[model samples]
Target: MKISSKYLCVILLCIGNTSVFGQSTFGRLKQKATGIAEKVIDKKTDELLEDKSGKKDNTRENPTEKVKKERVKKQNTVYDFQSGSTVLLKEDFLPDVTGQFPMQWYTRSKGEVVEFNDVPGKWLQLYSGTFLSPTVLLKENYTIEFDVIIDFPPNGNYPLPALKIGLYDRGNKGYILSNDYRVKNNVNIILSPYRNELRVKLKSIENNSNKIATENYILPDFTAKLGKPVHIAMDIQKERIRVWIDQEKIFDLPQTVPVSNLLNQLRLELESSNYKNSELGYYISNLCFADGSPDTRSKLLTEGKLESNSILFATNSAKIESDNQGVIKEVAAALKQDNAIRIKVIGHTDSDGTPKQNMALSQKRAESVKRELIEKYGIGENRIETLGKGDTEPVEKNMDPNEKAKNRRVEFVRL
Candidate 1:
């Protein structure tokens, strides 16, 4: 048979294409396999090196928790202040405008939300003799935890910073505006960070049953940790009270506080000192209040509702704060346990804006909660519903401007 040049060329082209395609496919497969094998070898090398070095892998863990665990191990003992089960009033001061007084708190003397070069977020800078109080009804059994930075030099010869944290009541005298240090019926916890000295007085209204307690401790690396954020946790149960600074329990006393004082407010007073210049400062953040007696299972499953103030949101936005993720994780776990159960998340806002605007804000916040549950918590989207009240269904009457804060919260209702 006589073959044309065209047919011969086509036959050659087919053969050439098949050979090229086969080589290309093999090359890709070989490259992929090599890449995977290298990954496996690198992982094995890492494991071997880790075993030889006896170093644990904590790269993926929270940095704050990693530091805490390391510090705990060094102590050779466990010091735990289990937080209150149900959060009541939590103020991260995220919504507060920097360089101004916080909206959620009342201050007689001037204090503003200020930033520190060493700290990560905003803090309330309390000036001397200023008493900052939050508007919330105090329960007899509750826990208060906050972070504070005392700007006094740790080893300076100058006078140290004196900060007083106290609980007081507003009687018929109309919010007794006086020296908090001398206030009767006030339970004061005085902190002197530089000297490592603390004095707590559970003052009685009658002045006869006052109980004073003093504590002196060798602060762990006091000079090294000065001006750094220190966690303060306090628990008050009826007449008994306890306090923890960082990981150490500095105060524990029973029947010291008066059970009948009806202390309805928490106050922070910075005493006047000669070192009250720019270097002399006091700042606080991450204030959390919770029910001293709480049953999480009962609150969620039986009561059919879960309330939290700690689920902080960004200023005028739906973005949840990263520090409050643990609260959402717990709710997600509960929902996952019971596949048949469904929940409706309701968001509320204080009476700060118009009803229409507030309603939209509330709805967006509710949707944000739903998104957090489904995306971060592995919950089914179909099992959740969201609603917003927007200052309509308030738990407390908006009497004082600060009182409006109680109306802003999130609730989970089981359906």
Candidate 2:
């Protein structure tokens, strides 16, 4: 006796669901489905699968000791940047198209999103000369955190890339900062790799006059770790600014710059004039900006819900990204403050993949969040429960890619 095609389809569905909902013993079924589905899917689908698997499709050049030292030191040091309790804007470049400029961002010169073997997510690669900024809500007191990888020449004798990371208050209409004639309150962080120095400059317009302050520091020796990624975190309060490079505190100067005025935009100006080719360039990823300090306890317990897209996870995989752990650590700290509180962690995903795949992925991600809170944050496991909503519920429509990204989030709800 043979089963009908309809029954066979139902059997497959059951198998897939069990594979997703069941214990790790049934994981092979999901893997089998992925293998079978890949054969019939288009090239784009295959690329997406590879990304979710946390593997690069192409080869990459080896990084130097500078990047390696940054990673090694990060493990022992707890990155204390709380990322402003309320995240206003977060850009991981996941919603953007590869090899094309991102939608929310504007650049006078050419800069496009591209995959990097060193990192799990997509990165914005700034060309020889480019000015890039995101058209998002910006506030005066905000925190900016991003990962930068400078591609040094194979022979260290060559001059490395020069990058200028600036914050500008460009009043209203114009796109480029040069054209913005209004009182432009600008704070610029300049990184000169060749001279092994970092500089912070303030150009503020007040009472129709300009006040400027400049601070410079000799960068720590990263000669051995060239080509490796560096993590940069900056905090701007009313009249003070704090900066951190890797595990080291670069500076925390009060009144070094005026922040009384509202500064609303971030700019990345990349230039490699001294370098020979585009290969001697730089990459930026995991750019997150958040302003205002909100009480986590009040936001979580009283409000009953807390949501963030800052929890970085590898594409398609349940493993959380390292640099993204700062936000999760913040969440864990808040929960540890109250032992009586019990919470439910819900995982969500966009409608990019099949329902079964998305369900399994979301469940794994939710479990990952719970695991971090318990083991890393030292929270009691009994107090937390996990659920995967998959793509069943979305906060926004999926027609727009940005909306899809908004839907793919993790929420902590009070139980």
- Candidate-wise lDDT, in order: 0.72, 0.70
lDDT of 2 by residue, 1-415 (tens): 2334654574477676775556564566556555555554655565664655677543432467557788778754655655666687788889999999899887667788889676688888887664656655666567888998776655566556568887766634344435444544666777776544434343444434566545566665554446667889887765567778885667665554455566667777776566555556578888888875443444675688888766767888888876242556656756876778889999999888999999999999999999988887679899999999889988988988889878888988988
State the lDDT of candidate 1 residue by residue for 349-395, as single tens digits.
Answer: 88888999889888998899899999876799999999998889988
Stretches of model 2 off by over 4 angstroms after superposition: 1-79, 154-159, 171-183, 195-210, 294-415
Say what the RMSD of model 1 is.
18.8
Candidate that would win on lDDT = 1
Mark the 10 consecutive residues where model 1 has the least summed lDDT. Answer: 197-206
How far does residue 92 in candidate 1 sit from its true spot (Å)? 1.3
Listed per candidate, the RMSD to the true structure in angstroms reads 18.8, 25.3
